[model samples]
Target: MKTISIIPVIRVLSWIVFLGLCIKAGAVLFTFTISLYNPPYAADLYQGLDLSILYSASRLDYIFLMAFAIILSSMQAFIFYFVVSIFEKLNLVRPFSEEIFLLISKISYFSLATGGIGLLAHQFADQLVKNGLVIGKAIDFWEGRDAFLFMGGVVLVIAQIFRRGIDLQVEHDLTV
Candidate 1:
């Protein structure tokens, strides 16, 4: 398939991912808000994921947990937004532009931030579990922390390449 044919497919997939993350973040926020007032709702926040034990143990912990979920999902969605933008700005014949470089760099930073936060949140969950909170499936939120970190590094390198590509393109245009 031509590269042009694939760009739209990838862009659509990115949009789907972005929308999914946004929905997830919204669901978590909604569940958290409801659980705060209803209490029993905490037993099954956002589809059968229970945090009631942690809720009963400490409201602060519960809030922090939900905040982590919201923040991570939102950050991932934000990263995908940049991904879509990158695809939108992409030109197969002239791929490197300052805007694309900035967008890629932004994605790298956001990915790194998401990974770091995920690691911290995972550690926090482990501590809670050790302390007898039993976060259960909630701890799975950061399961992709390592992957995000790796992607961040890779994207950072790509951003640097794009920067050089931009320089080269400018030089070529001047020579022509």
Candidate 2:
């Protein structure tokens, strides 16, 4: 079997991931918006997660926490979107290109930003819980910050490798 055959499968999987993230972000945003007008909705906002205590404790904090969740989800969706783009532009014959390098770098940077934001949100939720809000479940949304950071580092290294490949391809072209 040729590796080229696998590209479509990977692209389809990336699309699935991208769509799932978008749905997650959208669901959270919709729940947050609805909860603003319908406070009772806060009792079960997006899945089994409840933020009623946080809402009852401090509206500002609740809003901020929800904002962070939405941003983190959206950023994750954006990263997968770029991955799909990379797959779309991929050419097995000439895998190294400036565009691919830039896209990979963008994914790395976005992953780093998402990880940072997730960490901040995680800490903020912990503080809120410590301050007397039952936000234990809220932390679930901000989980996996470390994983994103690690993925960012790995992708950055891959991007650098692609950069070198591009340089070598260019040198070979010049010689020919």
Candidate 3:
């Protein structure tokens, strides 16, 4: 009987995530470009469905919206990159090394950072509507964004635990 290593599973899942994020980024770029440039054609091609993120936006607004998606996707992909890093960093050697904790800690903060940006965007939307200032701004976030902020706090605590573990490991090594 042989034991199965989990590293391969981790690697496979990370690859799936990486591919998914890339597809999403590419889709945003392609769809927004086509729909913005040729609205009627894109409607016919996509069965009358468009990205919908830039609904009610003018041509200039659509351009800014695409720029926003590029920035948003870049940030979103960064989180996945951190996930891939964690998976790649985990192995038979130094599984709990400083690199892992540092990476996780970054994941924690970046997750919170994204969530915070989403929150701010929402607030800005509210202000615009309240002021009757039609800036043609349209933005939204995942339902899980608030949850991401909460999880970031939890991960920060966990990173502190790992910091202690590193210190303890150092002490233990010194004693031997």
Candidate 4:
């Protein structure tokens, strides 16, 4: 029986953490988008929902979204460290050594950064629009950011899967 190394265990755990973070970030963005569509009041007199309740719910939703972003960013950084550690243990794909992991980490960081920025921008733009201010471009920009964040989360997940595949391949080769 062959003993599994601590390194591989850590690598798998890191990927799991990364996957969780991505899911969380995605959920936050999705919730924010939904909140935008569900306004407090509608002229159609059928569903008698309380305006104050709806407003409070949306406010709470926004707060949760912001918190999710912060948590995801912290998890991303931890994942980055774990990725580098895994690479070192496997001694594979060291063309640029830690530099490659660093670059990937930067990409993750940027995605989270832009996502947070977009959320804040959207909030303010929404306020301006509610105030009867003419601000078309701000809304457009916020939408763009949301799109960027969603895409970024997807790309990161793909990358993590690819890396896991490589690890499995290495394990197979060692066994054979």
RMSD after CA superposition, every candidate: 1.6, 1.4, 4.2, 12.2
Ranking of models by TM-score: 2, 1, 3, 4
lDDT of 3 by residue, 31-75 (tens): 766766676533322223343433444545445544555555556
Candidate 2: lDDT of 165?
99
Return the TM-score for candidate 2, rounded to 2 decimals. Answer: 0.95
Give the per-residue lDDT digits (tens) of candidate 2, residues 41-79: 999988867889889989999999999988998999999
By lDDT, the candidates rank as 2, 1, 3, 4
| Residue 121 C-alpha lDDT in model 4 | 62
Report residue 4 deviation for candidate 3 (angstroms).
3.6
Clash tally, candidates in order: 0, 0, 0, 0
User: Candidates' TM-scores?
Assistant: 0.95, 0.95, 0.72, 0.37
Model 1 residue 112 distance off true place after TM-score fit, in angstroms: 0.6
Off by over 4 Å in 1: 1-4
Q: Write the per-residue lDDT of candidate 4 for residues 1-176, one digit (tens) a residue.
A: 99766877776777777777566556544544554476433111112212233234455533443444434444454545546554555555433233444445456666666677767767765674575544322243345566657756875775576566657766777999
Clashes of 2: 0
